[model samples]
Target chain A: EAGVVQSPRYKIIEKKQPVAFWCNPISGHNTLYWYRQNLGQGPELLIRYENEEAVDDSQLPKDRFSAERLKGVDSTLKIQPAELGDSAVYLCASSGGFGETQYFGPGTRLLVL
Target chain B: QQQVKQSPQSLIVQKGGISIINCAYENTAFDYFPWYQQFPGKGPALLIAIRPDVSEKKEGRFTISFNKSAKQFSLHIMDSQPGDSATYFCAASVGGYNKLIFGAGTRLAVHP
Candidate 1:
C-alpha cells in the first residue's frame, strides 16, 4: 500500500505571508496528524483528526495556525502571517486505527525570510 | 512530565561496530515506547518498539533494551553499516497510539 503523501516538498515565503501545506493519508486510515519539526529536534504534534473530527488539537496555535480534515482522508495546515520561527518542516501522518503505528509523509519544508 | 530525554546529540561509529542511543522519560503513564529512523528528505519510520512488560526486544540488527524501573530505554545497532546512518528519535505515549512525546533525537553516522 502507498504511504502518506504530502505536497510541495519544499516552500519558501516571506515573513507575514500566508502558507499552506497539504497531506493525503494512507488508504483506509482513520487517524491523521499534523506535526512541526524544527532543526535538530523531533517532530511536535500540532493537530489530530479521527474520521473528520478533530479529536485532539490542544497543541495547535489557534491565533495563527489552522488545520482542516474535511472528509478524513486528506488534511490541510495553514499558517497566516507566517513568522520566522514558523520556518520548519510540516509533517503529516496517518494510522489504520487506534493504537496502530502511524506512518508519516516526507513532509513540506518551509522557509520564511 | 511529558519529556523524553535522549543523549548524545550526535554519534560516530565505524562499520561492523556497535551504535547505541539512549532515552529516558519521567511520565509513568506512558506505556508504549517506540523508536523511529529517518534519512535526509524522508519522514520517520518505526524501527523497533518495546513495552514496559518486556525487558528486551530485538529485530535482526536492531535491539531495544528497556529499563522500566529506571524509566530509560536504549537502542542498539549490531554491526552498524554506513547505510544505517540516520537520525533516530525515541518517543512515548500514554495508553496507546495517541499523541507521542518525542525526544530531541540523535544523529548517527557510520563510517565505512
Candidate 2:
C-alpha cells in the first residue's frame, strides 16, 4: 500500500505571508497527525485527528496555526501571517487504528525570509 | 515531564562497528517507546520500538535496550554501514500510540 503523501515538498515565503500544507493519509487509516520540525530538532506534534475529530490539538498554536481534516482522509495545515520563526518542516502522518504504528510523509520544507 | 531526553547530539562510527544512541524519559505514564530514522529530505520512518515489559528487543542489526527502572533506553546499530548514517529520534507516548513526545534527536555518521 502507498504511504502517506504530502504536497509541495518545499515552499518559500516572506514573513507575514500565509502558507498552507496538504497531506493525504494511507488508505483505510483512521488516524492522522500533523507535526512541525525545527532545524536540528525532532518533530513536535501540532494536531491529531481521529476520523475527522480532533482528539488532540493542545500543542497547536491557535493564534496563527490551524488544521482541518474534513473527510478524514486528507488534511490541511495553514499558517496565517506566518512569522520568520515559522520556517521549518511540516510533516503529516497516519495510522491504521488506535495505538497503531504511524507512517509519515516526506514533509513540506518552508522557508520564511 | 513529557520530554524525552536523548544524548550524544551527534555520533560518528566506523563501518562494521557499532553505533549507539541513548534516550531517557521522565514521564512514568509513558508506556510505549519508539525509535525513528530519517534521511536527508525524507520523512522519519519507524526503526524499532519496545515497551516497559520487555527489557530488550532486536531486529536484524538493530537492537533496543530498555531500562525501565532507570527510565532510559538505547538503540544499538550492529555492523554499522555508511548507508545507516542518518538522524535518529527516540519518542515516548502514553498507552501505545497517542501524543508522542520526541527527543531532540541524534545525528549518526558511519564512515566507510
Candidate 3:
C-alpha cells in the first residue's frame, strides 16, 4: 500500500513570509495528524483530525499557525508571517483508527530565515 | 508537564554489542506504547510496539520491555549494526485518542 504523501519536501522562506505544507493521507485512514520536529527533538503534534473535524489543536499557535482537513483526506498546514523559530520538519501521518500504528510521510523541511 | 520522558540524548555502540534506550511515562492512562526510528532527512517509521498487558515483546533483533508498576519501558537492539543508526522515539497514548505523547528521542550511533 502507498504511504502518506506530502508535497514540497523542502521549503525556504524569509521571516514574515507565509508558508504552507500539504499532506495526502493513506486511503481509508480515518485519522490524520500534523507534527513539527525541531532539531534533536521528537515530533510534537500540531493538530489532529478525525475525518474533517479537528479534535485536538490546542497545541497549535493560533496567532500564526492554522490547519484544515478539507475533505477528511487531504490536509494543509499554514504559517502566516512565519518566524525564524518556525524552522522545522513538518511531518504528516495517518492511521486506520485511533490507537493504531501511524504511517508517516516524507515530511516537509521548512527553513525560515 | 511532559508525559513521556526518554533518556540518553545520544548513544554510541559498537557492532555486535547491545544498545538500549529507556523511557518513562507519568500517565497511567497511557495503555499503548510504540517506538519509531527515523533516519536523517526522513520521516519516522514504526519499529515495534507493545501494549501494557505484555511485559515484553520481541521482533527480530528488536525487543520492547515494559514495567507497568514503574511506568517505564525500554528498547533493546541486539547485535547492533551500523545500519541501525538513527533517532529513536518512544511514544504513549490512550486507547481512544490518536494523539501520541512522544519522548525527546535518543540518537543511536552504531559503529562498525
Candidate 4:
C-alpha cells in the first residue's frame, strides 16, 4: 500500500513571505496529522484531522499559520509572513483510524531566510 | 510542558552490544506508548509499541519494558548492529486521540 504523500520536498523562502505545504494521506485513512520537527528534536504535533474536521489544532499559530483538510483526504498547511524560526521539516502522517499506528510522508523541509 | 522526557541525548554503542534508551511520561492518562526510529532525511517509522496493561513486549532484537508505577518505559536493542543506528523517539497518547506527545528523542550510533 502506498504511504502518505507530500508535495514540495524542500522549500526555501524569504522571511515575511507566504509558504504553503500540501499532503495527501493514505487511502481509506480517517486520521491525518501535521507535525513540525526542528533540528535534533522529535516531531511536534501541529494539527490533527478526523475526516474533514479539525479536532486538534491548538499548537498551530493562529496569527500566521493555518491548515485545512478540504475533502478529508488532502490537507494543506500554510504559514503567511513566515519567520526564520519557522524553518523546520513539516511532516504529514495518516492512520487507518484514530489512535492507530500512523504512516508518514517524506516531509517538506522549509527553510525561512 | 513536554509531557514525555527521554534520556541520553546521544549514545555510542559497539556492535553486538546492547543499547538502551529510556523515557518517562507525566500524564497518567497515557495508555499507549510507541517508539519510532528515523534516519537522517527521513520520516520516523514505528518500531515497537506497548500498552500500559503489559509490562513488557518484545519483537526480534527490540524490546519494550514498561514500568506502570514509575510512569516510565524503556527500549532495549539487543545485539545492536550498525544498521540499527538511528534517532529513536518515544511517544504517548490516550484514548482515540491521534495526538501523540513525543520526547526530545535519543540518537543512537552503533560502531562496528
| Candidate 4 chain B weakest ten by summed lDDT | B93-102
TM-score of every candidate relative to the true structure: 0.99, 0.98, 0.96, 0.97
Range of the 10 consecutive residues with the lowest summed lDDT in candidate 3 chain A: A95-104
For candidate 1, the TM-score is 0.99
Q: List the residue pairs that clash in candidate 3.
A: none
Question: What are the per-residue Cα lDDT tens digits for candidate 2 across A32-98?
Answer: 9999999999999999999999999999999999999997889999999999999999999999988
If the candidates were sorted by their DockQ against the true structure, best first, what order would they fall in? 1, 2, 4, 3
User: For candidate 3, what's the TM-score of chain A, rounded to 2 decimals?
Assistant: 0.98
lDDT of each residue in A1-113, candidate 3, tens digit only: 88899989999999999999999999999899999999888899999899999999999999999999997889999999999999999999998977778989999999999
Query: Candidate 3: misplaced stretches above 4 Å?
Result: none
- DockQ-based class of model 2: high
Candidate 1 chain A lowest-lDDT run of ten = A67-76
Measured against the native two-chain assembly using Cα atoms, what DockQ does each of the candidate structures obtain, in the order listed?
A: 0.91, 0.91, 0.72, 0.73
Model 1 C-alpha lDDT per residue in residues A35-96, reported as the tens digit of each score? 99999999999999999999899999999999999877889999998999999999999998
TM-score of chain A of 1: 0.98
Tens-digit lDDT string for candidate 1 (B1-112): 8999998899999999999999999999999999999999999999998889999999999999999999999999999999999999999998777988889999999999
Candidate 2 vs candidate 3, TM-score winner = 2
lDDT (tens digit, per residue) of candidate 2 on B32-75: 99999999999999999999999999999999999999999999
Over A1-113, each residue of candidate 4 has an lDDT whose tens digit, in order, gives 88889989999999999999999998999999999999888899999899999988999999999999987899999999899999999999999887688988989999999
Predicted model 2 interface RMSD? 0.6
Clashing pairs in 4: none
Q: Model 4, stretches more than 4 Å misplaced?
A: none
